[model samples]
Target: MTEFAPDAGFRKNRKLKDALLQHKALSKDGLSERLFSLLFSGLVYPQIWEDPDVDMEAMELQPHHRIVTIGSGGCNMLAYLSRHPSSIDVVDLNPHHVALNRLKLAAFRLLPVHADLVRFFATPKLSSNSAAFDRFIAPELDVSTAAYWNGRDLYGRRRITVFNRNIYETGLLGRFIGAAHLLARLHGVRLQRITEARTLREQRRFFEEEIAPIFDRPVVRWLLSRKSSLFGLGIPPQQYDELASLAGGGSITQVLKQRLEKLACHFPLQDNYFAWQAFARRYPDAGEGPLPTYLRPEHYPAIRANAGRVTVHHASFTELLAAEPAASRDRYVLLDAQDWMTDEQLNALWGEISRTARPGARVIFRTAAEKSIIEGRLSPALRAQWHYDEERSQALNVRDRSAIYGGFHIYGKAA
Candidate 1:
């Protein structure tokens, strides 16, 4: 099979495609649409924001379930694989993401030992990562995946060297977090101190002392007002509005402060890798902080055993779902990609999801707002097929270790 180039992920529904190609005479909506396209053109997420642990809890992954999920940064699929699902159909419209998912699946398959793999991904500064890639992962990659990672940037450094650095600090999302740290420093705050907090009280105290004051700064508030400033967070203009609405219009900074407090103080430093990555800019040393489920040695063998079960596709979720057999898939993880879709897109998506999902199939997704966008948007016929677990969703949202999103929702297909 021929490989898709890194630049090939732009193909989408005609409406979405047209939105991407909006001309200079564009109106407010047109400008917002085009900005969304530009943000997705490269690697948006170095690490995924939707917490997989919470996701697995909502989906209740079973060995018999055939899953389909958006392959963002490929972390969730890898996390899901630890459950030994019967199969996982991973789809993404971003070819870089496609390549990323491919690289991870290939690494789990080709790399000889768990420790070597850990050193390559977790050790941060390990120079031998490129060697590990060349020796174990490169040959397994398709032409496109190999080309993407090996390609050089303007500075002439190879893209593969991203692994040699703190890989978490290397993508669009990473740089956003890095900028946040820079802003905090300008306000004389050290975010990394939260990682040293030995108790929840300490974590709360550090946030009140160091992180909260920075949010009240004029520069930070001004920056938050610009949609383009948040392109690094993988948030589009539409999603930005949803978040602002959640904050009741004029309080984005306060909303962010509350969310960050949840990230820092609500979850333990030892188990909230999202917090570690945000505050410390790196996951903790082994046994110190929570590693993503797939990275832990205990789950390595199950992930490896099940890694081969994944089938990757470079297509939109709706496109792939429309092509699948009816009632064939049992678990759907939409991530927050739906937050970017139009009502037409949402109908098209859920229509196919409703068809492809088996009775009792569970769909879990996160949203920028506290409520799901699915209710009024999905047609009655399509919407009626699923039972929204509102009580559980509200409960899980509070428990989510990755506190970046405002809502965590679960919809179960009626049995």
Candidate 2:
């Protein structure tokens, strides 16, 4: 377990920092260690990478289901609330993430209406969001979480002031994407032009002419080759190994190019806000672009109605599950966190998952590789208790608009 400084945000995650260091591909490299330290020092995800639409289709969350998910950007968990789940437990190793989730819940409950919430999140340049926070949501947050957003940065400005800017461009991933845009400019490519393409052919043309060549640049490939360089993507060192193996002849740059292309060219720009955020550093529109389900206007009422159902905490999956009674949880959204675990960690996690999972409960996760990490890793007894939904996983992976992962996997507890 990590000890967090109540007002320190993510920089206080001692355990997570130690874990990532141990798993680092180049553990002895002082440079990698330092980069990992800095990367984990703040919120890594302003938007989650997993596609909740595909996840929702796979889980088929009933009104009775109890959902547990890794609270990345807290988007998908809020998205799940629209299904009217009985309860949702969202945990994160990063305190900043837990604070972010709590802040979202508070905003949903405190804001006058969905429009105010949208303006708070979607319209980043508005000063009204900060005012809304002070007037409505501030009184509702826990002491620690409120302190996080209220604390001033080195620049002597309130951290919450980011809401007055483009809040989506406010995290490690956001800065990474912004850096990518700068790099593209250096290569004489306007990455945003891909968003202008009206058809798949035009998208592909933009990629080949603008994006693909950026990947070929010497500096780009050099940076991509370093595992530390990818920490901004929320990829840990161990997952870097998996991505390397799957990158077609050990070229991780090639793998990133393929994934980026999938995000940019395989889906229509109007429909894939993931692409828009990646290139443009903000959604295509303030309230009209393809937004996350939780951020959309129609889903806002349901989210507010059920926002109280979510309980955010800072803990590991196994630790959280072990605290619950057997057959207590029904749906699991692990994201790609398992890729950072050891074989022993994998077995232990599955062991706890199998124990806590209700009969017919579904466990869904993404892998940096196209295969689930369960095979040949867990005891046969433990593995037999769950059945893999291979066909459905494959189908859903294709439908995943995020298109950032190699595979989407689902496992169901045998009835």
Candidate 3:
């Protein structure tokens, strides 16, 4: 069992530093990078933004497959268990995420009923949540994980109390959404109005009238121009550059507007929890709308039965792959971590991924721009080992309910 620890010394995390500190200290970009690292060292996502349904489809997960993925909010890994993967290895650099993943896994194992699980994770501000954690979840957690929940924040509130309140509105991304809501309110726009739409046309109407014009505001445009402004979205400076380039030298505000439009209008609110989180700041009430796959009652039995197969690690994806035997893993879900990697880091990551991937293994990832990041960056020999499924990638990219990513890519190792 890997013992989790508090994130008090995240500065000492060399892998995280190497990934974020690309510019010189005191430099404009460097300062932004440092600040993002500080914010990210804490919980970034209360629930991950990527669409696990699309990911599972792209990977073609099977019962015999051994999967390795970046465990952002831990939801995707739990969702993957619904497919009955042989096992899953979840890696992340943030201790908070590591602790959260462990807590979810423990909850699945010990929580008495599906409704209990829903109350603990889905419903917000329920005072019984912390008590449920103590009675059911805590005994199943490792010592360090229990310590993490028991530990108080700077405000002196126990970390577990977030469950008793609104966990969705508590993380960096959560606070980012809250700030967006505040900005909308200042402009006389109620962001939550989009959630009331009953149809796609109604959704589009709400977005055009209530949401799209915010990007045109002088203050909003100016703020969007700064790379640091998107740090709350977990987008690093390099990824911001990629997104800006997508506008063909135009204002990034336009690019952001287009993406936000997709998020708000592309999918129906009843089906997209991502939209609910962005606008409403919480999941829909049971039977009110769809929940994440892992949170749904139908999937709970499968997830709980297979929960033990997941092993959480506080490390980088490449670092974890390096320690595994060659050709051992059959599926890889990179999320958007590659957007933060440099050419050299990309090569190192692919080198290990190529080495550790079993024959016909599939790898899936998302990008900030409408193209694969590895196009010309990966070394030829390593790139030659995998075949990019361009058509399916594009199809999946369009189907992705998250709608935040510009591209969704899948690569299959040569058989």
Per-prediction tally of clashes: 0, 0, 0
Q: Cα-based RMSD of the predictions, in order? A: 3.3, 2.9, 2.7
Model 1 pairs in collision:
none
**Least accurate stretch of 10 residues (summed lDDT) in model 1?**
1-10
Q: Model 1: per-residue lDDT, tens digit, 32-55? A: 767667556667676778888888
- Kindly report which residue pairs in candidate 2 clash with one another: none
Global lDDT scores for all candidate models: 0.82, 0.82, 0.88
Cα-based lDDT at residue 238, candidate 3: 86
Better of 1 and 3 by TM-score: 3
Q: Which ten residues in a row have the lowest lDDT in candidate 2?
A: 1-10
> All candidates' TM-scores?
0.94, 0.94, 0.97
Tens-place lDDT per residue, model 3, 130-234, is 999888888778888898898877677888988988888877888888889999999999998787799999999999988888888999998988887888888
The alpha-carbon lDDT assigned to residue 106 of candidate 2 equals 93
**Residue pairs with backbone overlap in model 3:** none
Q: Pick the candidate with the highest lDDT.
A: 3
Instruction: List, residue by residue over 60-162, the lDDT tens digit for candidate 2.
Output: 9999999989998998999998899999999888777887889999999999988887788777689877888999989888888888888876566777777
